[model samples]
Structure formats: structure tokens, C-alpha cells
Target: MTIIRSLSEVSDNYRALFVDLWGCVHDGVRPIPGAVEALRAYRKTGGRVILVTNSPRPRAGVAKQIAGFGVTEDAYDDIATSGDSARVAMFRGAVGNKVWHLGPDHDAGFFEVPAILTDPAVIERVPLEQAEGIVCTGPFDPLADPSVMRPQFLAAKTRGLKLLCANPDIVVDRGETREWCAGALAQLYTEMGGESLYFGKPHPPIYDLARRRLGAIEDIGDSSILAIGDGPLTDAAGAMGEDLDLLFISGGLGAEETGTAIGGDPDPEKLDRYLAETGVVPTYTIGTLR
Candidate 1:
């Protein structure tokens, strides 16, 4: 792959960028070195930057967390979270509809419509027939019995209820540890013949929303936008599916340890070996975008 010593090479080629949050711009706790400056430089050159994250929280909440990390509101044009997209789908399809949630209560914010909220304690008391659709945001209790979840999925399927998945990722970084996500639960429900719609990375709608958010400030072409991320299944897949330039960050999903490369430029044989194993040939490779 092409080793870019500076961001200037791609600067003129793109008018806007949809930057990833966790590994690209910041760790869970803080911004990476030159991340703010790189974005500032891009903006100074008239490039619009949109921070796109797989955060399950609402966009407003995501922005607040970013601000807490010392990233000022002026650093980027707009921010979009997976929670926002899931909320969009819920409002469109399940308005005034009752929802049976299999995830945490924090995810309740996504269904803040006031009509869909149901207590887990009351799930056994309430008939499954009363629920509208199955919304899996994530596991309420990570250590909770997976077998206990089967009945919920089966009940939803038997009733022809819709399923909405907030985060498409099966796992995500929590501090230095990786934890399971709503997608894993969604996958289980899918195997049970339950119809489910997902929101987040590797989905076109979130990318489209991110594009629109960026477009408000400056023009961006599909060819000029670059997707920098660490997940082969979601971030990388999404970028490739959209046919955009991509720079894959290693070690996010253990791809650095196990993954193959695809079609890309000159790089070390070791890198080629890693890329070959991962099947995610990035335009560039780095330990971290910082």
C-alpha cells in the first residue's frame, strides 16, 4: 500500500471526509496526536469533515462525549451516530407501536417515543402478542443466559413482528477490552427466521446520512471520500461496498493478528501477508491513524 507521510496527498483529491471516531480520531478516552490538527488543516483547506461513529447513543449524546474528550464543536461539521439511524427507522416503521427490547435500558433512548418502552421484569407478565417489533440494541446482561433470549426471538418471529438492530457490529472496544454488541443478538434472531433491519456501519443509510451531513458544508464526490476504519466486516466492507478510498487500521478487530489483504499498492511482504490473510487490502496501513 501507499505509505503517505502526510495527509496532503489526499487533501486536494477530496472535498469532504467521513472520519471514524474510536480508532481513527481518538481512543475511548482522548484524541490522537495531530487528529485535531489534521482535521483543522483539512477544514482550513475548505474540506468538510464529519465524525461518524458506531456509538449507540443519540447524536447529541455522542457529540457531548466528544466534547468531553476535549474535541471542540468547531473541529467538525456534523456528527452522526448509529443510534440516530436506528431511531429514524423506528420512528418510520414503529411509531405508536409497542417494542420488545432485548438489550440494555440505555438503548431505551433510541426508542424514546414513549410508546415502545417495556420493562424486562414485566416481559414475562405481558403477553408477547402485545409487542410491535423486536429491537435488539445490545445485551442487557452480558452474562445473562443466551438460552433465555431464544424465547424472545421465537416469540417475535411467531407473531411476525419486525426486528430493529441499532448497532450492526457484533463487538466493539470498551476501553481496552472488546465486548459483544447488538449485532450478535441480531444474528441469533436472524437464524430463527426473524426479519431484522440493521443500522450502523456497512449500511448505506448511515453513510448516506453522513454524506448529507458533510455535503451541507462542502461538496464531496464518492471518489474523493475516504473511509478510515478498523473493522473488516463493517467499516472496511462499507467503504468497499460504496467504492470509496479506504485506509484500514489494524488491530481493531484482531485483524492485525488474523486477516488477509486484498488488491492494493506496494507494501512490505509482511503487510502483504497480513492483508492476504485478512482479505481487507487497505489503501494504506498504519498502527493507528494518529
Candidate 2:
């Protein structure tokens, strides 16, 4: 219930941070103001910052993309992406051998097996009719509605194929534009009688991956860690479910609901109501990372 202006107010309370990338570090197109600096300052204080993102790209790919936004390596210690988490599941045959990819061509990296897995299943991307399961990295067109995949979802439902959702985010803000994500398609598929599996935020798989990534560097416990993000459902819910303290960013996706203008604090009453309605209680609140 406490609202603060910058991350520095509580960065000393935790040994590490599980930070969301899209709305927290960058607005998809570029890094948000003061975000990169806040992370750098945290690192300078010997606090590790892990970019735990719902991005449906491998960690390396995400690094390359973030570099374009000026989110340099000095800002954070490591990254745990939804794509890498879900890719491990795919290579382990969580879906099946012949799977249909319900996403754009840019997500072809999702099929690449990780080098760490000793023996991985042979996965092939085939037509929906010839598939045993489905893998959704994202929608073919993010700006379009999710209902457009009803026809394909119906066919997949008839065959009883399991859909592995890489990114469990419904939408993300790219500059001033909001775009749909893989979670939208997975939600539609489940609603239309198809089974869908999630590996991102609010789910245990990605969190496990994040812990493993953190363990590689230092032996930290959950009590000493904090989660920071902008999304109410994904970030807030995930942090709460993991029993970790969360620093909610009101100026990102929840800006309109919380009456938070850019680079400004949110209306207390509006922020409280939004959290109550969404059922997510964070340890702290901030306008932005700084």
C-alpha cells in the first residue's frame, strides 16, 4: 500500500530483483526514462537485477533487441525469458513431435533446442491438420483481434492438441501502441475447448528458470528477492503467487486505470481500486523505475 517515487527507496531491502523488461525497462521500442539508470545504480550497490521477461525470444535474442534500446549489460546481471523456458518444454516433448506454430516467421528461433539439454525430442513444424500439438509464440498479426484464429482453434480442438504458450502476456505497450501476444491466442484456444499450457509469468516454470539463473551467480533465497513490473495480472500476480515482494509500476499498462500520467505518481484512490479489482497486492508502488 506504500507508494514511493523511485526504486532506490527499497533497493537496499532486497538482495536481488526479478524485473520485467517490456514496460519496466523499455517500452518495446526504447528504454523508458530513468529505468536503465535505476538498474545500474542497484547493481553498483551490489544488488543483482535479473530481467525476468515474458518476451517470447531466447535470452540471447532478447539481449540483442534490448541493446538496440540502449539497455546495456551494465544495467542488469542476467535474463530469464519466457521463450527459453517454453523452448525447454518444447524440446522435452511437452507438446509433441509434429507441432503447428501459430505465430509469425520471426519466432522461428523458438524451435531451436537449447545446448544444455543432453537429449531433446525432435520437433517439427507442420500443418495444423498434420500436427499432434500446437505451439504459439505469438499471433501472426499483433494489432488484430484474437478471435481471428477461431477456425484454426476449432480444428485443433477437434483433434485435441495441447497448445504450449511461450509468452503468457495478453498484451504489451510498444511506445503508445498496445499489441496482442501469445497469451491471447492461448486463451482463445482454451475457451474454444482446446488445452493450453503456460510457461511464463504467473506460472511456475519461468520462475524456476529465473531461480536457476540466479543460483548460478549467488545463493539467494526468495525472502531476499523482490519482483518489479507494470502488468497487474502477469507481474503482480506472479510475484504474489511466488510469495515475493512486488514493486508495482503504475505508469505502464495500469496507467489509465491508476490515473498515472507519464513520469508522475498515480492517484491513490484509483490505484487502490485498480489493485482491489485485479486482486493483486504489491509490497510497494512507483511511477517508474527511477
Over the stretch 43-149, how does candidate 1's per-residue lDDT look in tens digits? 88887778877777787778888888877776788997787887777766642256666677666566554233343212211235677776677887754544567
Question: Each model's RMSD to truth, in Å?
Answer: 5.5, 0.7
List residue ranges in candidate 1 displaced over 4 A: 5-9, 94-96, 113-129, 142-148, 255-270
Measured on C-alpha atoms, candidate 1 has an lDDT of: 0.70
Candidate 2 segments whose C-alpha is farther than 4 A from its true place: none
lDDT tens string, model 2, 1-290? 99999898988999999999988899988888999999999999999989999988999999999999999999989999999999999999999999999899988888888988999999999999999999999999999999999998998899889999999999999999999999999999899988999999989889999999999999999999999999888999999999999999999999999999888999999999999999979999998888
Q: Lowest-lDDT window of 10 residues in candidate 2? A: 107-116
Superposed Cα deviation of residue 60, candidate 2 (Å): 0.2
What TM-score does each of the candidates earn?
0.82, 0.99
Among the numbered candidates, top lDDT falls to 2
